[model samples]
Structure formats: C-alpha cells, structure tokens
Target chain A: MINIILNNRQESIDVDSMTVQELLNHKNFTFKLLVVKINGKLIKRDSYDEAVIRDGDEVTVLHLVSGG
Target chain B: MSEMIDTKIRQHLSRFRVGIAGCGGLGSNCGVALARVGIGELVIVDFDVVEKSNLNRQYYFLKQVGLPKTEALQHNISLIDPTVRITSHNTTIKSDNVAELFGGCDVVVEAFDRADQKVMLIESMSLLLPDTPLISGSGMAGWGNNHLIRCEQYGNLYVCGDQQTEVSPDVPPLAPRVGIVASMQANFVMEILMRKKV
Candidate 1:
C-alpha cells in the first residue's frame, strides 16, 4: 500500500504496478479534461500510462470544464 | 487616480504586458480590471463571439454580439483606457502554438473555459517561458462563499477562486462571484509587477 493526497485529501491505496492511468481509472474520474499532477509536476495526457505514482506523493486532479 | 494607486505604481503598471487566453467571463472581466488600472498592453485571445447569453457576465455590447470575442473585448478595454495597446487574436490556441502566441507577454493569464486548454497553457508556458508568471482560475462556480475566492500561488502560477466549486446550468457563474475572482487575478498581476509579496 502507498499513501497519497488525492485532490488535497489523504488516502491509502494498493501499490501494485500503480500508474497514474490506473489510479485515475480506479477512482473513476469521468471527466475528459483533467489536469493531473504528482508532487506538483504535470503529467501530460500522453504520459499517463507511464507515469508512476509513488507513496506519499501529492496528487492533484483538477477538472477544466468548458465554462469561464 | 493617484489617490487610488500611487503614481509610482501606476507608472510601473503601464510597462507590463498581460496576455489573456479566454475572453468570456474570466478573461473579459480580468482584462477590464487590468485596463482600469492602466496596464500598458493586453493580448486578448479568443475565437468565440458574444451571444445573448454572454450578457450575464462577459464584457460586450448588445450590438457587438456577432463580433469575435477578441475584437469585442479589445474595443471594450479601449473604452476603459484608450492608451492600452490591445491586440486581439481570433485563433484557436494549442500547446504547440501558445508560447508563440504569447511569447512577448510578461504575465500570461489562463482565462480559458475548458480544462484541457488551461492545463495546456500552463504546461506550455512552463516549458517555453518558465520565469513568466501564469495566473489561472479554478472552482469558481455559482454563488460561492466570496471569501473563499482568494489567491494561491504554486511556483510561478497564481490562481484565484474557490478551488473546488464548479458551475452548472442550475448553478451558473453569477456576475458578482465571477467578477471577484477576476479582480483577484488582476490584483495578483499588479503585486507581481510591483514586486510586492501579497
């Protein structure tokens, strides 16, 4: 298991081969326009599959909906 | 005017260049604030147009409905401060082109409506202009606790909004709430220009 902050809240999750893509699917974030960051570093859409999530990483998932 | 802002600060503000990414509620409102304070130049970028619906928040005249947002906003900003050198870009912005489009800007404001564009602007600018401050908005939807609409800085990025609230059809982005966030974003720009840590 690993600890991470999801959207500013602390949570523990299984660490088995966990990647940002898997973590997003596991949490069921349905929004298409998402800004994913781990420890304040942006994870672009292409790298989601390869970006790994580590223990104690601060993850921020922000949605940029179509409105101003 | 000197009573509102010191002459020295006002003089310094006239030398800053601000680039706004969207011209809807956030972009238009933020531009107006900066223009009123006499920010020298503004590059307003948006491909959309004013509609009857936009009257609720965006800056535009009823007669200017069909005009592109960039054009309409430039006209409006000029009304606030004729000396403001305004450039309007009627084009779509992508990660590949944002840096090129906004390269001359001292501070680039992320006023986009979509999440992807906001993130793209931030990421692209971080790569292309790492030292430039990027101000963005998030979570200001509906009539939220206005006090929650405060400024937060992460590295070179400064954001003003209630970071988690969102707007929906039922809970639209009301005038007062949106204006407050826009004003706060403009305040951050001035602070950065003045070298004040506020």
Candidate 2:
C-alpha cells in the first residue's frame, strides 16, 4: 500500500507493480505529454521503468494537453 | 512627432520578445495587455480556429469566427499598438521543435489549456532554455472567486491562477476568472522585464 498526492489531491492506491511506469499504467494515464515528478524530483521518461514509487511519496503527474 | 511616455516600464518592455504558446483566452488576453504597453515583439502560436464559442472570453469578433486563431489574434493586438511586431505560428507545439520555434524570445508564456501541453511546455522549455523564464496558468476554471487567482514561482517557471479548478463540461472557463489569471501572467512578464536588465 502506497499513498501519494496525484496532482495536488491526496490518494492511496494498492497496486501490483511498484515502478513509476506501472503506476501510470494502472491509473490508465495515456497522455502524450506527461511529466512525472516523485517527491519533488523530476522523473525523466527514460527512468520511468526503473524509478520506484515508494509509500508516502508525493507524485505530480502533469498531463499536458490541448485546450488553448 | 514622438509620443512622450511617463515611465521607464514602457521602455523596458520594448526590449522583450515574448513567446506565447496558445492564442486562446489566456494567450489572447495576455497579448492584448502586452500590446497595450507596446511590447517590442511577440511570437503567438496556435493551431486553432476561432469559433463562435470562443468569443465569450477570447479576443475575437463574431465576424472573425472560422478564421485561424493566430491570424485573428494578430489582427486584434495590432489594433492596440500598430508598432508592436507579432509573428503567428499556425501549428501545434511539441517537444521536438518547441525550442527552435521560440529560441530568440526573452520570455515564454505557456498559456496552454491542456495538462499535457502545459507539462510539455514546462519540461521542454526548462530543458532547452534553462535561463529563460516561463509563465503558465493552472486551475483558472469555472466562475469561481477571482481572489483565488494568484501566482507561485518555482525557479524560473511561474504559474498563476487558483491552482485547483480543472475544466470540465459542467465547469467551463469564463471571461472574468480567465481574465484575472491572464492579466496576472501578463503583469508578471512586464514586471520581470522591468526588474531584469534586457
């Protein structure tokens, strides 16, 4: 069980995979322009598969889309 | 004859070449504000067309509907200051060419509406142009309280707005709140220009 703030909102999730990429897949985030930050540290795309999502981590999943 | 200006703020702005990513509500309003002050140059990017729906908050006329956003906004801003130079890009901004597109700008305005585009702009701009400042908006949605709109800066990335509201079908972007955040972004740009030596 891990608790993380998703886009400023607090949430807790229990998932099988513990990597950052796995969490994004579990949450079904398919945004093309997503910048993931874990505990204030930016996670580059290359590190997603290896970066671990620990318990009580603060994550900012910024999904860039087209509105303006 | 040259018109006499009262303050040096106007002179400071003349040295800036601001890059605007979106020409919608935020970009259009901010451009108008900068144009009023006669910013030296602007690079306005938008791959959208003016619809009847955009007239509520965006700076476009009813007759301008169906025209491209870049063209419409350029025409509108030109009315405020004919001397201010504006370059319009009729394409979307992606990671690959974003830097090259706005390379010569002094500051970049990230007025995108989508979360993905905003994130892309922030990341790409920060990575490519580390020293250049970027102003963006978040959570300026619905007809909520205008007082909630404020700005917070992280390094050179300054984000303005309520920082909570997300646009939805029920909670739409209105003129008042959008105007507040847009003006805040524009004001920050001018303030940065004034404080920093060009």
Off by over 4 Å in 1: A1-18, A21-31, A53-60, B1-5, B196-198
How well does model 2 score by local distance difference test?
A: 0.83
Root-mean-square deviation of candidate 2? 5.3
Residue-level lDDT tens digits of model 2 in B1-198: 135553455777887899999999999999999888868999999999999999878989999999999999999887887888998899999989888889999889999888778887888887788688989888788885867877876557787887668788988888888888889999999888878875
lDDT (10s digit) by residue, model 1, range A1-68 = 99888866898997744788899899998777787778778788899999998888888776664456
Worst 10 residues of 2 chain B by lDDT: B1-10
* lDDT of candidate 2 over A8-54, digit per residue (tens): 67788885338888888988987666767777566889999999888
Estimate the Cα RMSD of every predicted model relative to the unseen true structure: 3.4, 5.3
List the global CA lDDT of all models. 0.82, 0.83
Which of the numbered candidates is closest to the native, going by highest DockQ?
Answer: 1
Best candidate (score: lDDT): 2
**Second chain TM-score, each model:** 0.93, 0.95
List ranges where model 2 is wrong by over 4 Å.
A1-42, A45-68, B1-7
Q: lDDT of model 2 at residue A22?
A: 89
